[model samples]
Target: MRLLNNLTVRVLIAITLGILTGYLFPETAAKLKPIGDLFINLIKMVIAPIIFLTIVLGISNMGDLKKVGRVGGKALLYFEIVTTGALAIGLLLANLIRPGDGVQTAAVKGGDISKYTEQGAGMDWTEFFLHIVPSNAIKAFAEGDILQVLVFSILFGVGLTRMGELGKPLILTFERLSKVFFNILSVVMILAPLGAFGGMAFTIGKYGLSTLLPLAKLMGTVYATMFLFVFVILNLILRYYKISLWAVLKFIKEELLIVLGTSSSESALPQIMEKLETLGCSRSVVGLVVPAGYSFNLDGTTIYLVMATVFLAQVFGVDLTLGQELTIIGILMVTSKGAAGVTGSGFIVLASTLTAIKVIPVEGLALLLGVDRFMSEARSITNIIGNTVATIFIANNEGEFDRAKYNRVLNQEAKNELADYKY
Candidate 1:
């Protein structure tokens, strides 16, 4: 009874039952999408405000402006290096595995991907950066634009810091407001299992398990690559910083399950940030790195974009040269940064990359439509882990982390697990 009451266990059960329900009664399962959608909307409703207050507090509390710039600079540089490495790995593995080779494109069903392609055609790399500075802060908050909100938060925090003692009252008020929002979030998280069930059910019901048969190899390759990236490459990065990857994963297990269930990393952002702070990362680091990571440091999406592009090239029998492959990397480095944590954004980035290259058929995107939902879980989980590790790394580097606190929390968690086991 105690185990059944656990949210992680409940979410896991919900995912399994959701799959079964979709398989047995897809029509009923299809109707559950709104359940997931409503849960996601509830999450989004609080995201902009939480980000604004948390960041403002983090910055205003930290008196050093130069450290803020340094942290942000280091984060962007790290994102570029790691994501580029991920792209290269994907390209290398795709060439070696040839997942799309000898595939039957004729038997495959293609969807109307023109919307993605049209969006791709209109994707301006310059405009993406320029759009980061919002013309109107009200519209930015109303729309839940993460980038714009982030820019404003940083500036507001800086302005408040300049006010010194005068800012204390406002900071206290924001602190109270932050607590209120987080309290509300705790209430919202109780419904995670239903969101998990509805999200999984809708995917399986609408797409059906049989849809994966035609593209099993591609799906397998993608999952395998992500697994390697997380455990191998990301693990190496964490080890260099003297942090335990397994420990971090264990700490954030609940958030990871939420991301897996919903197939949206955004669903778990606030919770993940809170957990990171609890693990001893500074508020300034978590607030800055996580939100920025959503836009800039998409390791999983970068891997998928590169691999999918190369896979399509093989499917169409368009042989890419060494120079062409390098060009693909360069192109993806810019375009992949535009992909958010949302589900369909990966396809948009891929479409934009293909449009830029022109060697691969943009229509190849339709080949992926069926299996994309299934792979989204992989992408989202990887992304959240990547950002979490990034925060820990940056915090440790800047001496903002509390190792004593981290150890204490981990020990307490271990004791709890032992008690739960004996129960």
Candidate 2:
């Protein structure tokens, strides 16, 4: 029972064991890739509904229906500040470390191009944004169109607010339903370590050590940047708002653990939503801000995209020239936002970016592909911090956050204050 409670420890062990298995027996690990895919499918199965339920409930519960606009402004503002800092850090790292200059990628030229080429067509910028609005909401879920699901959730929530007293029963029902879905997500999270292990094993088996290479440089830069963003940057942000970063983390410990293992921030959404609302953030603020954040506020993915593209270009002896670097940023700005909040989204956005730049060989993606699973942990962690901060900051500006409630609910003595609250 104690071991089950220590999700972080279990996840660490899983990652360690996975690396060992892949290192000792690459072929077996490679063959076991489907296990990783199955794990991803399992989590993805719950995400759309989780997003919808949380957003709808979160919005419906706002004390006043009109606060949504103030919430949106502050939330978007918060996202911009945090994400810009992320982008700057990524750029700074890329410039300083020159992650690409050292090595020669011998096998990069020979991977099967057929697998990537076919998947990349018709993936233009216009088509990407267009896909955000679903032709049919149900079909969107079936197809994993997260943005569309988000759009539907927001509209539904707004509809609820507009209906006033007539919608109370339905709103109450959705609020309960969101709680039920979150309970289900908690059960699913028990598999996180298994998912992480399988995914890491597949990564190692596919790429091997030769693929990721002298990890200290690139990995260190990314990990360091992520650490600074959360600890240094977000710590300041939280402090400015008279909140405790430690307390916020303590509150979301379970969700943080899930993101660490799954490497998919989206997987942690329901839990984050539940925890935030419990922390005194108005539901409407959380609803609009969080889903929109998933689409518009991808600080982690964007930073990684910038750093990785530069790293690849530098490694291949290609000069990005000042103009091209900006071009890369411009491309990333759009593509990373287009990324849905799901596992493997970073890779898809990276693929899109790679396709756009024509600077590095798409084959370079194959290089990172090997270590991508490990890297996902970093991206996921950054995303978690970015969103959590965004949610709170927005709530503060709109007067939607009950600072007094935050203090009370987050106080150690008030541990179960929200235990009786409706979902």
**In terms of lDDT, which candidate is strongest?**
1
TM-score, prediction 2: 0.86
Tens-place lDDT digits, model 2, residues 1-423: 444456666877887778899899999987766766666677778778877877777677764556666676777677766776678788877888887767557644334444544454336778766777888988988976667998888788788878889999997787677677777777877887787778677667777877556544777777787787788888988888888898888778767765664567766776677788889987777777877887888877778888888888887888778888878877776777776643356666777778877878777766665566678778877787788888888878777798777878767534443432322
Off by over 4 Å in 1: 341-343
TM-score of each: 0.98, 0.86
Locate the minimum summed-lDDT window of 10 residues in model 1.
Answer: 335-344
Give the residue spans of candidate 2 off by over 4 A: 1-9, 23-28, 31-39, 63-65, 107-110, 117-121, 214-216, 341-344, 408-410, 413-423
| lDDT tens digits, residue span 1-423, model 1 | 888877888999988988999999999998989988888888998999999998999998778999889999999988988999999999999999999998788767778899999988888889888988999999999998888999999999999999999999999999999999999999999999999999999999999998898889999999999999999999998899788899989888988888887898889999998999999999999889888998998888888899899999999999999999999999999888888822369888898899999999998999999889999999999999999888888898888899999999999989878887999
Local accuracy by lDDT, each model = 0.90, 0.74
Residue 254: error of model 1 in Å? 0.9
